[model samples]
Target: MPRVSTDQLAARRQQILDGARACFARYGYEGATVRRLEQTTGLSRGAIFHHYRDKDALFLALAEQDAGRMADVVAEQGLVQVMRDLLAHPPATDPASADESSWLGTRLEISRRLRTEPEFRQRWSSHSAELTRATRERLERQRRAGTLRDDVPVAVLAQYLELVLEGLVSHLAMGLPADDLEPVLDLVEAGVRRR
Candidate 1:
C-alpha cells in the first residue's frame, strides 16, 4: 500500500476522536462500548483497536483533550476570567461543534477510576499539575498587583482553586447544573480576593 500523508493521518485521527466524542456524549462512559464507537466512527473494531489499545485508553485520550483545552483557556485568560466566563455562559464539551453531547458526565466515571487505577491517576495528575502551574503563575501576578489577599498563601490558594475546579467536574458528573456552581465560585473568589 502507498504511504498516507501526514495531513491525512491527522484528519483520520481527529475523525476518530470526534466520533468517540459523539458516542460518549450520547452514551455515558460505561455505556459507550467499542461496538458503539465502531458504529459512530464507521470503522471496524479492528481498525479502532489499531489506534487505541482498548476502551480505557481511548477514553483517556478524550479526557486528555478536554484537560488540554481547559489548560489553554486558563493559561490565556487567567483563572479568574476563566471562572467568570464559565459562570456567564455554559459551554458544551466542544463549543465549536454543534453536537449537544458533552463530556461533563464522563468526568465522574474518571474520578471513580482514579481511585483504583494508578496509571489513570498518574495521567490525571500530570494534567492537573499543568493547570495548577498555570494558575499559580497567574496568582503570583495577582499577588504582586495587590488583587489577592495577603492572608492566604499563594500556593495554598492555587491548590484550593484547582481542587474547587475538580469538585466542579465531580458535581457536573453528578448532574449538577453548571450554573448552580456560580454562587459557589463567587464565594470562593470573595474568599481569595483582597478586601
Candidate 2:
C-alpha cells in the first residue's frame, strides 16, 4: 500500500539487473525465461514488469551495465598495462593449475549470447568504439615514445586489432586451443610493433 522511495526502487532495480547478469551468463538470452528470472530475483512478475517492460528491456539494461563496467575497468588499466595483466593472468589457466577449460567455457557462452542478442550487439559495438578510441590514444602515446611503428596508420591498425581480437574471441569460443593463439598473437604483434 505504501509507495517505495526512489533510492529503494533503484536498489531493487540493480538487484534485478545483477540477477539477470547471472542468468544470461549461464543460460543466454534465448534460454533465459521470465520465470527463471523471477526465481533468480525472488521478485514477483508484477514487480519485475514494473521496472522493465519486458525481457528485452531488462537485457538491454544488463548489457549497458556490463558495458559501463568494462569501460571503467579498461580505463583504469590503460592498454599496455591491461595487456600485461592479461598475460600475467592468462584466461586459459589458473595460478594454482594449468586448466583453462572452465574459463574458456564461460567466455564462449558470453560470446554466443553477445552474437545472438540484438541488445548485446548494440551495446558491444558502442563499448568497442570507446575501447578502440582508448587503444588508439595509447598507441599514439607509444608512437611518441618511439615504441610503435611510425609507418602504419594508427586508426587503421586499431580497427584491424579490434577485428582480430573479436575473431580470436569467436574462435576461442569455438574450442580453439590455447596453443593456437600464439601464431595469431605473433602476427598481430609483428604488424603493430616498431620496425
Candidate 3:
C-alpha cells in the first residue's frame, strides 16, 4: 500500500544477498533450502523470493557480486592482487571465520555447478567473460606501458593468468599451505613481465 524509497529497496536487496551468501556458503547450493534461506535471512520466503525469483537466481546474484568484486580488483590491482587478498584471508575452516570466507564457498560452488549443471554453466558464461575481459584489459595496459612481455599475445597472457588464478583457488580450497605462496606469485608475475 505504501511506496518504498529507492534506498530502502536497495538496502532490503542487500540484506537478502548478504544472508543468502552465508546460507549458501554454510550449506552448498543443494543444501541451502528455502527454509534455511528464510532462517538465515530472518525474512520470509515471500520476501526472499520477492527479491529473487528463486534459489538459482539468488545464487547467481551472489556469485555476480563476488565476480564483480574480483573484476574490480583485476582491473585496478591486477589478478595477482586478487590472489594475494585471498591468501591474506584464506578460506575459513572454522565456523567463526566462515562468514568472512563466504566468497570462497561461492567460488567452490560455482566450480561444482559448472561441471555438473549445463544450464548453470550456460548462465554463468557472461560473468566469467567479465573476469576474462578484465584480465585482458589489464594485460593490454601493461603491454602498452612496456611492463608485460611482448612475445606473447595479450589473449594468451590473460588465459595464463586465469589458469593460474584457478589453480591458486583450487590449492587454497584444498587447505594447502599458502605460506610459501608469495614466491610462487612472484614467479607468476615474472612469467608475464618483460624480460
Candidate 4:
C-alpha cells in the first residue's frame, strides 16, 4: 500500500466525521460503535483510531463541529431570515429534503447523550454558556433596534427565546407541520414585541 497524502488523510478524517454524524443521528450516541462507523465510512479500525483517539473523542469533535455549523447557518441566515424561512417553507415529509430535520435530529440525539453520558454532558455544558451568550446578544440587538420589547430583562427574554426555539425544533423533528409553528411564534413575538 502507498502512503496517503496529507490532503487525503484530512479528507478521510472529514469523511469519518460525516459518517459518524449520520450514525449518531440514526442510532444515538450509545448505539454508535466504532465497528459500525468503520462499516459506514469503509475505513479500517486502525484508520479511525488514528484520526480520533477514541469514540468519545470523535463524538465530542463531531458535536462541536455540528454546533458550530448550526451557529454559522443561523448567523448567515440572520434571525429574521431564519424566522421567515421557518414560517414560509415548513419541513419536508422526506428527511433527506429537510436540512432542519437533520439538524433537529442531531441536536436531540446529542441532548439525549448529554443526559445519559456524564463526560459528554460536561463537554456539552461548556458550550451551552457560549450559546446562551450569543443568544443574549441577538436578543439585545433586537431590543435595541426596537423590534423586541424593552420592558423585560434581556437575559430573561433570551432564555425564553432559546427555549422556544429548541421546542420548535423538537416539534418540527416530530413531523409537526410548519403551520403548527405560527401560534408559538406569535406568542413569542407578542411577548417580546415593542408596545
Candidate 5:
C-alpha cells in the first residue's frame, strides 16, 4: 500500500483502539490476548506491538480513555446545571452502536473485567474516586445554593449518584425502546428537593 499520512496513522490507531475495545469487552483483560487483538484487528503481531507495548498497555489505554470519558460525564457541571441541561434536552451522545443489547454486553464485560482483574481494578477505582470527588464538590455547591437537600451527605449522595449513573449507562447501552429518561430524572429531582 502507499505510504499513509499522519491523519491516516491517527485514524488507524483509533481503529485499532476501537477494535481492541470490542475485543477487550468480549474477553476479560487476562483472557483478551495480543494474539486475539491481532486477529480481531487483522493487524500483524508486529503491527499490534508497534502500536501497543503489550496487553496490559493496551488494556490500560482503553481503561484510561473510557474512565476519563465517564468522569467528564459525571462531574460535567454542578448537579443543578447537569440536571437542567439534561432536562432541557435528550442526551446528545447516543451509544456508538444502534443495537441496544450489544452496548450493555460490552459495558457489562468491561465492568466484569474491572472487578476481576487487579490491573483494571486499580485504574477503574482510581478514576471512579476522582469522579466521586468532583461530583461531591458540585453537589456541595448545589447544597449551599439551596437547590439540594441537607438530608443526604454530599459525599454519600455523590457516590449514590455515580451508582445511579452507572445503571443509567447500562440502561442506555441496552438501548431499550424508550430512550427518554425524564421519569428517572423526575424522581431524582423530587428526591433532592429541600423538605
Candidate 6:
C-alpha cells in the first residue's frame, strides 16, 4: 500500500464530511443508512468507515464541524447573526443549491437527537459548551468595551442568547413564519446591549 500525503488525507476526510453532510441533511440520522452514505459519498463502506468508526461517529463529526462554525460566528458577529443568517437564507428545496438547507437540516437533526438520545446528548455537551464559551467571551469583550449591559452576569447573558437561538431554531424548524423576525432579533440584541 502506498502512503498518502497529509494534504491528500485531509482532502479525503473533507470529502467524506461533505458527502455525509448532504446525505444526513437529505435524510435524517436514522434515514442515512450505510448504503445511502456509500452512494452519496461515492465511496464504499470500507473507505468511509476508514475515516469514521461508524454512522454515529460520522454524524458527530458533522455536528461538531457545525458547532465550530457557529462558535466562530458567535465570536465574531454575536449569536444573533447566526439566527439572522438562517433568516437570510430560507431553507432551499434543493440541498445542493443552498448551504442553508444543509445547515438547517443538521441543526434540526441535532435538536431531535439531543432530546431523544441521552448518549448523544452526553457526547454533545462538550461541543455545546464550546459555543457557550464563545458566547460568553464575546459578551465579556462587549462589556469591556462598554457595550454590553453590566447588570447581568456574562454567564446569564450567554444563556439568554443561547435560549433565544434555540427558540429561533425551533421556530424555523417547525415551518413557522420567519419573515418578520428582524425586529424581534433586534430586540434581543438590544436587551443585552448597554443602556
Against the true structure, whose TM-score is highest? Answer: 3
Candidate 4: residue 18 lDDT (0-100):
80
Model 1 C-alpha lDDT per residue in residues 37-93, reported as the tens digit of each score? 898888888877777888888888877776666667777766655565544534345
Model 2: residues with Cα > 4 Å off, grouped in runs: 1-7, 78-128, 145-147, 178-195
Model 5 scores a TM of: 0.63
* Per-candidate local distance difference test: 0.71, 0.63, 0.88, 0.69, 0.62, 0.87
User: Roughly what TM-score does model 3 have, to 2 decimal places?
Assistant: 0.92
lDDT of 4 by residue, 69-151 (tens): 65554444333334544456455565344443344546777777777889778778876665666666777777788887877
User: What ranges in model 3 sit over 4 Å off?
Assistant: 95-97
TM per candidate:
0.77, 0.64, 0.92, 0.75, 0.63, 0.91
Q: Please tell me which predicted candidate would have the highest lDDT against the true structure.
A: 3
- Model 5 lDDT, full chain set: 0.62
Q: Once model 4 is optimally superposed onto the true structure by TM-score, how far is the C-alpha of residue 79 displaced, in angstroms?
A: 6.1
* Deviation of model 1 at 185, angstroms: 2.6
By TM-score: ranked, best first: 3, 6, 1, 4, 2, 5
Q: Find the 10 residues in a row with the least total lDDT in model 3.
A: 94-103
Which of 2 and 5 is the better model by TM-score?
2
| Model 5 C-alpha lDDT per residue in residues 1-195, reported as the tens digit of each score | 899899988887877777777666556456567787887777877887787888777766666665555446556654434433433422224323223212233445557767678876776677556656767876777789898889888877776676666666555545453346677766875676676
Cα deviation of 22, candidate 4, in Å: 1.1
Tens-digit per-residue lDDT, 109-178, candidate 2: 4467676777767656765566777778767777888878889888887777666756665654444454
Evaluate residue 3 in candidate 6 and report its C-alpha lDDT on the 0 to 100 scale.
95
lDDT of 3 by residue, 38-103 (tens): 988899999999989999999999999999999999999999888888788777676334663446
Model 2 residue 109 lDDT score = 47
Which rank order by lDDT, best down to worst?
A: 3, 6, 1, 4, 2, 5
